[model samples]
Target chain A: MPPISFALWLLVLVFDTGGQLAFKAASGVPGEGLGHWRAMAVRPWLWLGIAAFTCEFVTWLAFLSVVPLAEGVLLSCLNMAAVMLGGRWLFGERLTARRLLGVALITLGVVLVGAG
Target chain B: MNTRWRFYLVGFLLLMAIDTGAQLCFKLAATHAAPFAADPGWLLRVLREPWVYGAIAGYLGAFVTYMTLLKHAPVGPAFAASHLQVVSVMAASAWLFGERLAPLQLVGAALIVLGILVLARAEDEVAQTTPGHAR
Candidate 1:
């Protein structure tokens, strides 16, 4: 595998995590009585999140063109870890032992599946 | 950490379901034709099967729901759970496509559930503290 693939994979995580955070922040606000779908569409944060995720999909496609899907999926698991850290740093979300252990399990489990 | 976050977790679960459905349809479509890997007009051939279109629709559905979920769910756990997509797509492939999963993969699936249980417990604690929807 080319080192560039790994580098691109990390970039994929950055965009993905940013997308998630933006989406959450956008959604976290209380909505007016304007109705749910209409309300979400109107938020600038939601639009920003959408743009970030669109970037993620394009970068992901580029990554796939270079890397095998299986390998790409495996590497993409790191996005979970990145987001978890982001949660702590950005949102002050708790990282209790139970949650950390759970994350560890997911990471290992997904890698095993990718190995198939 | 609020009652609102419960709604977010529920939405996260829904997104996971959508994600799994997308993966399944994509796999079914791939076994039939890999339009992305092939030349032009591949869309017509690939789109012949409903699952091809289903795959795209499912992905879109997942994308929308995930953003909605981020609105209230605690960030770390919600993001962690989406990784369940990897485990789910694998399990779905084994069952639907008759693909063989190694014994280790089965173990992997079990581990995923265990992890989810741990995360769920933590979230439950948050849900309990929330006074009510208004609080």
Candidate 2:
């Protein structure tokens, strides 16, 4: 991949992972019904997530403009692994053996898609 | 299926449809505003496309549907079900946009889906084993 495309792809990954993590944090608060939505609305994490997604939306569009839609989408799957790691690091989520195996397989699959 | 199961099934299906539609719209918007530049002009070009709005609408719809579904659905299965859009988008791109994946890429896609399934099962197992665990 060219430098520009690689940059755009990286940006998309960063923003997507960040966005997902932020949303997770925002939603972790305990509530139900309209109160849940209202609570999240007042939180910075939710807004941050929305902002990151807005950035990701643009970056993803830019990335797709440079690569085939199919390839771009496949490559974007790496966000799953990235988010999982973020969860482990930030939220203290346990990375069990099975989860690790799953992450490894996903990483390998992404590599093949990126290289092929 | 029970009404509750039926609700989940419909919700997940709707999520997948919205996600797939969003991806296709993004692609269409990108194509319509081709020759991407890292500039305001390029951004403006993208904004001018109706498909971009379609993509935005899809995103909003998917978000609302996903949040609603997540309340009643298991996180593990819900996560995996949401991602099934990857497959749907791939098929749609091939059929509608004439995008062809290389043989290796096709294999890669399969592996990715399988990995997701494994992860989903792992999540369920972990949740079950860890008493008082909040996911």
Candidate 3:
């Protein structure tokens, strides 16, 4: 497989994070059942989430087209850390020492796996 | 969606499993198709693979389940739980593709799980204790 490009993975990072935010926002709107979910289908936030997810899919496929599954997934783990940061910054979520250590370990894990 | 912890755990684990299956199918399709840059017909050929369809189906199921999960839980914990897919995929790769993780990779995988666990607990604490959480 060809090497995955930095730009592609970066795009995935952005899209994935954006998708999560959209979904979170969309979930706040009231919906009762499968039918009410149809109502949400038209909501902008949900649409945005779906759109971002669609972009993520395209970018992810492009990345996988070049990189091995293990490597691609290892790199993708960066999203978890990124999302945590985003939550703190955008949502006013607290980041305690434990969470910080968790993020650090995740980054360290990526390095170890990537090196291997 | 704003449900009890036990139900949330079950839903989260189910989503993770489906997500792993979807990714595995994508990998299978990618392995089968010629490189897109090398062959203009690659996308069309890839679409012909049953695994590609399976990937789409699996992804749709995950997406739907995830939308539901979003309501019952906060994004932080939900994402943290969903990321269990990475570990699931690692094991699935070993079982299905005969791939083996290096010792370093194994250690790395452990850290990933540990990190997610720590993050999950923190998120859960935030959700349950924060004001306006409505229990």
Candidate 4:
């Protein structure tokens, strides 16, 4: 891979992982229905998530501009793993054997589609 | 089903719907502005396309639905579940665009569904053991 493509891929991964973790943090607020939405609206984490996602979109578009869409899709599958690790590290979410097996299987499935 | 499972089912379905809608909108936008070029005219055409706005709306709708689901659903499985759109988009393309579905892709789609079922069972187990756990 070229340097520019590699850089764009890295950017895509970072932005996507950051965006998701931020959203998870933001969504941890308490309440229900409209009240929950209102509470999250007043917080900064939600905006942070949105901003990261916007950046991710731009970076991802750039990545796909250089890389083939198939390879891009395959690479993007790593974001799921990245987010899962982030959830475990930052949020203390459980990562049982069953969950790991499930994620691994899904990642393989996506890889097959991308490679096919 | 209990209220918790009902919430998961409804929320995930809505998310998948929004995601499929967004992909379709983007496909329409691209088709409308075909023969891609690196020029102002092509950019202008994409900007002028109504489907582009629909795509943006779909993105917003998906974002809201995802965040709502994240309130209770774990990010890992929720994200995996979110990719169900891949299967939906493939099916849509097959039906609407007359695209051919490779056998490998079909196998892959099946694997993805199986993975989600396992993850769902994991979540159910966790929920049963710890009543107040969000996932």
Candidate 5:
């Protein structure tokens, strides 16, 4: 891929990571404070997440506009890697030895999948 | 390869990544934010955030990707590949949000990843055998 395309892919990755984080945050919050509708209208940050998701969808469409379905889907495997990295770095999530091992194996599997 | 398809693929991957990341953030935000105080009020409060908007955008992007993938690839493989989101999201949820998965769930995630990898390899083999131009 060209450098620019690579950058765009990176952008998509970042946005996706952001979106997932937002969902977790929303779901994790306790209690139904203002009901569903009221909460949606009042929270600006929530909208921010929604916007991120919108960007993600648009980017996906843009990707489909060019690449074949199979290739596009295959390339998306990289998202798992991105999440793993993001979870570790941004969230301070524990990478248990077992989980790390799983990640390593998964990485190898992804390589094979990409190469095959 | 056509530059457009290459761009699309990259864009799709980025969106997927952002989607996953945003979910994590939302979870974090939830931890800090007040618990749902009222049904509709809380729901509205959560939905109105810009982050939520971004996630909505990402979902749309994913929808487009899915449609295009279906258009270009066989449904079976496309569906299989799309399911990666499940693994990505769940694993992140467990680690970032402290959501514990049973040992069985962890094993299930591994199985899903393994199955997809195998399928991806099969697709690659088929692609290699085909005589069409890369683009």
Candidate 6:
């Protein structure tokens, strides 16, 4: 509940959003002169994306060191909402009214679990 | 109960949410960015962006959380439960990005939510039954 921990959590969120964007950018590159596997393997951004994912896994382990499993998993689900918001804001992705409603429901569910 | 575990749990949740967000963002960014032309140096060019730093930071947090969680939690349940994020991402992607979702997928999401709720309740019951704990 300390401010520092909360701030850390927020940092995690931002980093996560950025990582995804990087991966997306990397994955979008079309095949260059290299063969399919070779081209993919050679992408610099893709490696960065993979590295980002590796960091994510490491952080997850660190978090687990301090939290109960079930509780951790429940809280982590909040990422869905964060991702949706990030996609809309950063990528200008569309969120239809229906999907927004679904997100709202999920948010409500998160609040319920958090409060409980 | 150690308060540290609670902190860890909250941290894990937040990171997971962020992780999901990152994936979605990546998908969108890929969609908008220009396709890779068959240039020789395109790969090198993509590697040098600032965004890559962000990804690294995110992944570091995730890895730490995972290690901590694995120490105390059942791996099977932990992973099985975490996969729900995939469903969450899929649904959000379809709804927000206009990606198609089959009716079955919708049902699957609903089922996942239901299962999670049930599991959450069950966890609470078990916690309550156990003695000498404040969590």
Query: For this target, which candidate reaches the highest TM-score against the unseen true structure?
Result: 4
| Model 3 agreement with the true structure over B82-116: per-residue lDDT tens digits | 75676688779988999978899788779878887
Output the lDDT of residue A41, model 5.
47
C-alpha lDDT of all candidate models, in order: 0.77, 0.76, 0.77, 0.88, 0.55, 0.53
> For all candidates, what are the clash counts?
3, 0, 2, 0, 124, 43
Tens digit per residue, CA lDDT, model 6, A2-116? 5544554555555565565554445344553344336546777557756766677776666656666546556666665666566557544444444444445544454443333
Docking quality category of candidate 4 according to DockQ thresholds: medium
The candidate, 3 or 5, that scores higher on TM-score is 3
Runs in model 2 with CA error above 4 Å?
A: A1-14, A55-80, B1-14, B29-50, B65-84, B132-134
What is candidate 5's CAPRI-style docking category based on DockQ? incorrect
Candidate 1 chain B lDDT trough over 10 residues, lowest sum = B126-135
lDDT of 2 by residue, A19-84 (tens): 877777776766887898898889898899889999999999889999997689668877877777
**Docking quality level of the chain pair in candidate 3:** medium
In model 3, which runs have C-alpha deviations exceeding 4 angstroms? A1-12, A57-78, B1-3, B31-41, B131-135
RMSD of each: 3.4, 4.9, 4.3, 1.7, 19.5, 19.9
lDDT of 5 by residue, A10-62 (tens): 66777776665554334333334346435544655456667887898888777
DockQ of all models, two decimals each = 0.63, 0.34, 0.50, 0.72, 0.03, 0.03
lDDT of 6 by residue, B19-67 (tens): 6766765554444443766575554544554454455565566644553
Candidate order by DockQ, highest to lowest?
A: 4, 1, 3, 2, 5, 6
Q: Which TM-score value belongs to model 6?
A: 0.43
- Model 2, position A92: C-alpha lDDT score: 65
C-alpha lDDT of residue B101 in model 1 = 81
CAPRI category for model 6: incorrect
